[model samples]
Target chain A: MALTDADLVARVLLDDDHHAFAELVRNHQSSVRGVLRQLTRTDVALADDLAQETFLRAYKNIRSFRGEARFSTWLYRIAYNAFRENARKRKELVGIDEEQLQAEQDTRTVDPALRHDLMHALSLLPLHERSAVLLCCQNGLSHDEAARVLDIPLGTVKTNVLRGREKLKRTLAAWGPN
Target chain B: MNEMTEEDVLDRQLLEAAPYIDDNGFAARVVSRLPAVQRQRRSMRGIILVGITALGSAIAYTLSGGGRFVNEGIVRLSNFPIWLLFVFAFGSGLVVGACAVIVAIRKTPEVRNLRRLQS
Candidate 1:
């Protein structure tokens, strides 16, 4: 069997093994990048940059990782913070404009127009609701885990996911067949 | 087969759609940015060893009558003036208090998290 995350963490911590850390980055990069993409409203380049920052921060603070949570959970927390910080900076520079927000949400390059509509509906969600829904639905994190990643209460996470799903359903209802 | 509801169809479509961007060298870019891990570990080990050695020397000095020698030296400086001694004691206390506050701040979770991000 492949080494567990705990084993990889031990190698990185005890042996300062770069290969172990590389394996970690390889394993989790997709999920981390995906979450950031969603959180950043599909700003792929910015998402990738934040993902890189997240991994570097993880490596620097490897010693501080107390292992109380799963390694992935801790990494997600860091990614969430990185995304928030980057978003804050961007907001300060140029407040989120509707046209730019719509552009950022347009990820489907060749898909049908319905896909674009779906993405637009998703983009209409409040940030917390969007993050909560994406973390729980697309990213496959449990509600509790999503709560931890978003640094929100469990009830708030539940409320966001429920409200987000309802909004998506309502917004897409126009396209629904009679 | 059961008839699919509209919500079910939409949910399936959303779930099946690829949500993540394809990793075209993203991992390599991140790995390249990482610091030299072995070198960092070596330097950290050296610092830790030096710290332990310094702490041990200080303890040994205190146990080996260095404490008394320092006390005697301070006593000899008593010839300066009573007010001078009080000012010296207050200055030393302020320095010690500041060092303690710095160490405590470094140990706080928020500071540690900020340091990790900044690093």
Candidate 2:
């Protein structure tokens, strides 16, 4: 049986167990990377770099995690902050260059059509809505948790998710079932 | 089958479109690149512990009239006979050396236990 995150965290805290931390990294890397990839507007290389930084920061500050949130939620908070900090350093979002994003996406051959539609629609979303949607829909974070991760109010999270979903529905309407 | 809400369907679609990235040695890369954070934390804890201990010792020493005791001992030592003073100095040296050795041995078990647990 897999160990609970608390169990693994206890091992790390009490014994400084690298193996336990590695287990955590492996478990959460996908979602953390995914959220970052979308946030970076499909900048795979930059997203991966930020994901690495997120894990590094997480390791360094693991003691400060108060456990009121789920482990993944805590990781998401770190990942989100890392992305925002990098974006600020790079001087704001500056909007997406969709053509470049498309070129990058083309290099991967997995479910191209659906992934393409999803990425494009996500790009069209307003920043707040996109973050809310990604955290709630794609990353499986609750609205309350998403609010915590994005540092937005819970009401704002709910509003963004509703608006984001409505926009996504219209943008991808051709692909939706009747 | 037809009862799914539009929001539910869209959420399902988004979830499906999101891919799970394979590790492909990502974990190893992260583990390799991690700083010596645990070691840094341990050393920091040790520093704080030492600082607190030194402060406590200073306060206790002052409260116990340690300086006066040392001064009185020195004055008394000067008054002792030469042979008795030599014996007193030798015994004091042995006692201090034994206390140092005992403190060193007491720290060894903590390290041994850590190694045993990790193994």
Candidate 3:
């Protein structure tokens, strides 16, 4: 029988079994990667580092997961926290140098040659709005699920989704208004 | 211009263009790293255990008779010599530390693929 996430978590917690911990990583890696890629503007290096950090953090804190929700939900929460912490650290490291940071952001702003201008526009959004769109629209997560993953209220999620859509519309409209 | 919103475009484009982002070998790599993490943890535990045992032995020897405990029907290690306790502690610490370092070296990600696999 396939081991449920709860069972794997239980095994790891009880015996510190890395195999069980690995199972958890295997289960949610791709979806985690997908959301992370969108959030970090396909900065694969940063996403990979954060993914590893996320799993490590989860391994350390598995005992605190009370199993009140699905394992993916709990894992998503960890990923979100990892992204938040990394972003905060990045802001601190960059100091008040908006020019350098904006240049970096511009570089990450999707290749113009790629025909997927919509996706490129989505990547340009503020982190919260982009995250809300990815989680709710692309990932098919409900408002409540997105809110839980983002540690925000459902109403905030709704507003972000609305604003994110509006911003993307404006961005794409400037691109020949297709 | 008609009312073709970006959301409408993205909704359709994502359905068609969001190539299933499955990073091949991700699980395998993660699982492969597990044994090393486990070994590191186990060796650290072993090192701690050995250190504690050696310390207890030395403390007990210092607090009581400084004699060597032999296996001649002895039930307690309290009679072990202070010199033996020192030797055992130092030797055990060396062995445990060596094992821990070896495990850590072996576990280092020499061939790890850490790039975000977003294909």
Candidate 4:
């Protein structure tokens, strides 16, 4: 049987086991990176860097993992903070370059026009709304879990998702359902 | 079309179409960047054990009349040249001054900022 997250955590805490930690990195890397890639507007390189920082921070603070929440949820919280901090720094610098954002969206979308429309609609949403929708809808987190990850109230998470969905629907109505 | 149902359909479609990137050694990359695991702090049990042993030793020494020996040794040392006392004081001051300088250098904002940028 595969080791539970708690089991791996115990190994890391008690024995300072790198191998166990490596297993954890392998297990959760995809979701963490996926969330970041979306959060960073498909800036894969920056997302990967933030993901690395998240894991490193998690390792440094592993002893503080008191099993209060699911390990993945805790990890998501760290990833969110890393993304927010990097976003703040980037905002302080030159702000996000429009061309760069378009280029990133271009690479990820399969149907250029439709994907571009959807991406544009998503980009129009406020950051918190975008994050709440992504976490709850795309990332398959419940509203409660999304709230925990975003460090916002449960009602706010629901409101963001509702408002975000409504906005996307209105924006995409011209395209209609394929 | 009912507004609520139309919006729900769009939400479902968007969720199902969410992009997922392949890992492709991402985990290995993160593991490579992790700093070495720091040494865990000493446990409370170990600290308590050491404290108990130290207290027990001190109590045993006191009960065994070891204080007389310490007093006699101090008396003999006191009889030595007064200049020797000054030398000892100066040496102690030098050691403390060096330690303070080292700590100050480590605590400087530049050093801390450099470390932060590196990490």
lDDT of 3 by residue, A20-74 (tens): 7777787788778777777777898788777777777777676567665566777
lDDT of model 2 at position B5: 83
Itemize residue pairs with steric clashes in candidate 2.
none
DockQ of each: 0.15, 0.25, 0.12, 0.16
TM-score of 2: 0.68
Shift of residue A152 alpha carbon in model 1, Å: 1.3
**What lDDT, from 0 to 1, does candidate 4 have?**
0.76
Model-by-model lDDT, in order? 0.75, 0.82, 0.70, 0.76
Residue A136 of model 1: what lDDT?
A: 73
Higher-scoring candidate on TM-score, 2 or 3: 2
Model 3 spans with C-alpha error above 4 angstroms: A92-115, A173-178, B1-17, B28-119
| lDDT by residue for model 4 (A17-72), tens | 88889899888887888778767766888988999999999998886666766788
lDDT, candidate 2, residue A154? 99
Q: Which candidate's TM-score is highest? A: 2
What is the per-residue lDDT of model 4 for residues B6-115, given as tens digits with 9 covering 90 to 100? 76676676666665556688777767776665543446668888999999989978986987777887898899899998898899999999999999876553333333
Highest lDDT against the true fold, candidate: 2
Please write out the lDDT profile of model 1 over residues A34-64, one tens digit for every residue.
7777677778788888999999999989878
Per-residue lDDT of candidate 2, residues A100-170 (tens digit): 43554455343338777887778667677889999999888899999999999999999989988887877
Candidate 2 Cα errors over 4 Å, as ranges: A94-112, A174-178, B1-4, B37-119
Q: State which docking tier applies to candidate 4.
A: incorrect
Model 4 TM: 0.63
Best candidate, DockQ-wise? 2
